[model samples]
Target: MLTLLLLIPIAAEHKPLLLERFRVIDAPDPATRAAAIATRADEIDLVLTNGTVGFKADEIAALPRLRLLAALGVGHENLDLAAARARGVAVCNGAGTNDDCVADHALALLLASVRALPQQGAALRAGIWRDALPLFPHFNRRRLGIIGLGAIGQKIARRAAAFGMVIGYHNRQPRADAGEAVYFDSVARLAAWADDLVVATPGGAATRHIVNAEVLTALGSGGHVVNVARGSCVDTAALAAALRDGRIAGAALDVYESEPRPPAELVGLDNVILTPHVAGWSPQSIEASVMNFVANVEALARGEPLPTPL
Candidate 1:
């Protein structure tokens, strides 16, 4: 039987299913975890982890029997892809498993930021009858620009369409199904053209800091930005500076450059909306992600290619 190291804790509903076929082990300490992995190198054939909890290259080299490395979530930004490819190890991710949930959360951030919902809610709690007060900024007929036109971007595009927003996008290659939206060959050009920007590209070196000061400035004043993609895709320091200096109108983000803990600069910003890095997490999305991983594992065991191979 193949030994699988279940890096993250599995839900109770899925625990029985995992333990039935493979020898599963959980580690309470990081050193103990590394030790367990190293000690069982010869017997372990698969490693299950998320992008944030990827196995290092040295760890991979130690595991002679390791054949497959699976990312439980869509973002594999931290995974060492070059090493995995060099070792002939198959890497797979649960792409599209949580796209709907992420898109929904992106919209939540967009609406909240655009309409200043948080500030409005705060005013209401203080018994301020602000109906006659000036309403917060809105997107209205503004153009929404998306950086990536993949599955997640497509979902965001569909939602944007429902809001009567014009859409534009920039990608490595032009997509034939982008509908009525125009496509830009460069990110800067796209930002220059869009009134609001939502980044939905994959996370990796290729996409790191795609939204920098130049892009932010190009987005121009009275523009809003939303990010449901990897945090590395945006320059947080630049974004914070822009927000402080009014270089841009406002921003909303579900992911930060330094996640789990946001930058100190953003903590006091009234124009920015922040949430923990959980845009892709929902009850339904969790189930779909787990099932996708299980399907990949089962396919691998049967000597078949993964449905969403990285």
Candidate 2:
């Protein structure tokens, strides 16, 4: 049986499924991870991690026999792809498994941010009526720009269709099948054309801070921004500055620069909405992701195509 290191946290209910297949070790915290790998590196053949709990280069060096690295979520920004390639380790991720869940959350953030739902709800609780509150924009019939035109971005576009929002996207290259959604070569250009911009891009050095102050400036005071991708993709300081100066109308995010911790710079902003990095987390998505991990592991063992390799 292959020995697998479980670096990503799993729901207690899902633990038994993986444990039955491989000799498993749960090392979810950073404190225990290095020590666990150090002690069992020779025995570990496969590793399960996520974008946040990424397998590092040093960690890869420790595992002399490591053959596979699977990211439990869609984003694997933290995973060292180059290191994996050097070691001839197969790399896979739970890509399409969580698309719907993340797309749903992106739309939720977009609607909430545009309508100022959370703000108004709080005001109502504080005894203020609708008549006393400032007016907010309607979510529908506006231009929507997606920063990435991947599976999740496409799903978000389909959802936004009901709201009559015109969709556009910015990818490294224009997609031939993007259909009616306009395409842009630059993120800032996409932001300029959009009334609301939703960032669904991958994280990592190539895309880090892809949505910086320039993009925010192009988004303008009438624009709202939502991020459902990796926090590293957006500059937290730039976002905070934009909100402070009204460079953009408002912003919503499920992921920020601070992972497992809230971005302190944004805590005081009334024009912003924040959620824990849970855009792709739901009981359904978690279950799907776990199954995807199992499938990849099984395929690796059998020399078959991986179910989802990124």
Instruction: Name the candidate that leads on TM-score.
Output: 2
Error of 1 at 80 (Å): 2.5
lDDT of 1 by residue, 56-82 (tens): 888888888888888888878777778
Give model 1's TM-score versus the native structure.
Answer: 0.92
Worst 10 residues of 2 by lDDT: 133-142
- Each prediction's total of clashing residue pairs, residues at least 3 apart in sequence or on different chains, is 0, 0
- Indicate the residue-level lDDT of 265 in model 2: 95
Q: Could you tell me the TM-score of candidate 2?
A: 0.96
Give the alpha-carbon lDDT of every model: 0.85, 0.90
Model 2 misplaced stretches (Cα beyond 4 Å): none
TM-score of each candidate structure, all chains considered together: 0.92, 0.96
197-236 per-residue lDDT for model 2 (tens digits): 9999888889889999999999999889999988898999
Least accurate stretch of 10 residues (summed lDDT) in model 1?
131-140
lDDT of 2 at 87: 86
Instruction: List pairs with backbone clashes in candidate 2.
Output: none
